[model samples]
Target: MSESVVSGLTDLLQRMRQAQREQPHPDASLRRIRLDALAALLRENRPAICEAIDADFGGRPAEETDLLELFPSLQALAHARRHLRRWMKPKRHLAGLWFLPARTLLVPRPLGVVGIIVPWNYPLFLAVGPLVDALAAGNRALVKMSEYTPRFSALFGQLVERYFPQGEVRVVNGDAGVARAFSALPFDHLLFTGSTDVGRHVMRAAAANLTPVTLELGGKSPAIIGPGARFESAVERIVYGKCVNAGQTCIAPDYVLLPRGREADFIATAQRVVARMYPQLATGGQYASIIDDAKHARLIRLRDEAVAGGAQAHALAASSPADAGRVLPPTVLTDTPEDAAVMDEEIFGPLLPLVPYDTLDEALAYVAARPHPLALYLFDNDSAVQRRVEQSQAAGGMCINDTLYHVAQHHLPFGGVGASGLGAYHGEAGFRTFSKMLPVFRQARLNGVGLLNPPYGARFRRMLDLLLRR
Candidate 1:
């Protein structure tokens, strides 16, 4: 940034802080206003957002954006707006026997300003979805759009600036240096969505401010096909999640965990599914391109590593080298050794590795051995096995018969445990994420406990003892 721009930003931030400090009770009305503005901003910029995303991807499919990104955000916005008032209501609670005359309530208080670091994979939804929570919880938001999606970031910044004031909603755009500066600020709360490695850096930076953080980080999420699983449905759902945004989603199924005797059949079914999904190979209009060349190169290297380790590789029948514009074939590998490079790292690409497991226990053991995934897919109908898997293993969330669909339900809490990430946000969870639940006990004039106030005589002691004896 130029000297003038930096000075302007510094001045603006100071002014916003002053305004927030001067507000009476953080102005819940201001929160509603910001949300209303956000709805307007999105409604107005829908076309422009689609265009910028297309420009970034050298022409992303508008229909796909509508189906996958735009429509979902609109739906989320409507749902949040409709329920914001009730979510903000003070929740009444049961008073304990000891505090008999006091009424308990959970008072929702806003954390002053929040910082949201959005990723590029699904820039539209990722940026706005969390913003919904921040606004609903009555907190001011400062957004950092990813540098990878430059066009969309620039446009989004413009929309935010035009509709909202810095004190209400602000957008910051830049490369890593600017991101570092933004993250270093002592915001009241910080929410980040990205890789596990970068999530560490964000947490470190937020620690400087002593700021609480909610990380929606991703890892090697796994999809396991059990013996009685429906191969076609399982493969289709897994492929759909992975292929969305060309396998750049944080929660996309990283690889497949195949049962021993069913590996070949699963592979064959997956190939057929891919063919049905994307008929024209690399240049298929239905398929999306990888976000950038660097990611494409990394996936290529991972594929080469698997090949070098003597795993049987099958390239998707339709991937043409000529039209490989950041395009990777929906490839699969078999006979993958436990020590293979693909097994060592998170496979954030279209390549699927099939690691055969001898039994259900072995499959559970394999997943348990790795860092807990953000989402786990268990494709079995047996209630006993499902209960066992759910009890024995830990994950951010699980989909019993499918993959990644659990996140779509606004009622569910979405986040990871252990290494996957910390904290969850979706519906009420999102509201709570940005809210401080202050416990309040409203007292009545007639307090029965006044009888024992500092007059520890024989009668008081005897009464206290009688009350304490359960």
Candidate 2:
């Protein structure tokens, strides 16, 4: 919070910028070295990282951190290491007849120093995920870790400093004021992963510098249970998706849309799955706690407001009592009024609302009426039903019969649209996002372009006609 600390952000950026100027384009070997160091950092400090996140969250099981965060972070490095050579290579393009004897190729160039703002929900993965892309693209990076998870953020900063050279990768940790200072820096490119409201501010600040930004924001992502869906299977998957991280995931299914009469069945299956997954319920180490008291209170307010509006609450983890840790039990609500806050806002917690529909088209229409979501889930085996939703709807990504799995596909572009967010970054999409694919054209020594360039003559007119026709 000190003035010196805030100014240090500009210092970190300037150092990275100076280093980038010294070596604008790093070779594949150097990029691989960065990947190796990052991998080693994750591999060696698994226990410490898990412990830090657990402390930050109050009590998140180590296995969940390993599966959801650590494993993905390391996997991203390996994937980048394996493909960086090819990704860095220039892509050849065929010359068109209009420009015969000329060749074209797209050369991927790094976008200098990148600024990444990481969110608290999945701090480790979000930090490393974008860093992988920036490093692979041969750019130095400055990362901002969320203040909400101070323990993990500090530990991560320490680990990064130990693994990377001073200017290659720097991690900044501070409160909102510090974050504002960090974002205000004139980074070459910026990527942020967080809520939509904050994403807007990040974009506005970046606009001052005309710095390109990639906003991975979140909205009310939904899951639709098609008429042809294996009802029980759909419930099980939805339960897993919502319950993972105790529904703290950005891409978690916010609510369920199902056929009107099947509400009881969905609730039955979901409760059963939750009980099976968490076994001990409230105090189980398998489940996670709400990030903090404020988030917990917000979720409680949403639930209270819904119930006051005539909704019925069903406790998925009803068997066990509340634990000392701030863990919120998985919950489902029914009969909530259409305009309730729960129905409108992004529910980044364990409370799942049921939005019943008479027909598949009704469900689709309901989703379309709202802001486009970061992710859409459809549970159906019928090809027609699948195609109908896939083609007619808009989402950052779609999972035919699963939830939260689309993000695991490193090959696919992971991002949102409309109110959900602004851009994508994952694997190749990420590589391109952090780079500029410059189109290089090489003309033959004896080309005829000169012939078409004259003082508005008859030959020029003829060539213009031919060009227009082609």
- How do all models score by TM-score? 0.94, 0.98
* Candidate 1 lDDT (Cα, 0 to 1): 0.81
lDDT of 2 at 306: 98
Q: Could you say which candidate leads in lDDT?
A: 2
Tens digits of per-residue lDDT, candidate 2, 159-184, equal 99999988999888889988888887
RMSD of each candidate? 2.2, 1.3
Residue pairs with clashing backbones, model 1: none
Q: Rate the local accuracy (lDDT) of all candidates.
A: 0.81, 0.91
Q: Which stretches of candidate 2 lie over 4 Å from their true place?
A: 1-3, 319-323
Worst 10 residues of 1 by lDDT: 1-10
User: For residues 316-380, what per-residue lDDT tens digits would candidate 1 score against the true structure?
Assistant: 55665765577677788887766876787778778788878888788889899999999999888
Runs in model 1 lying further than 4 Å from the true structure: 1-12, 24-30
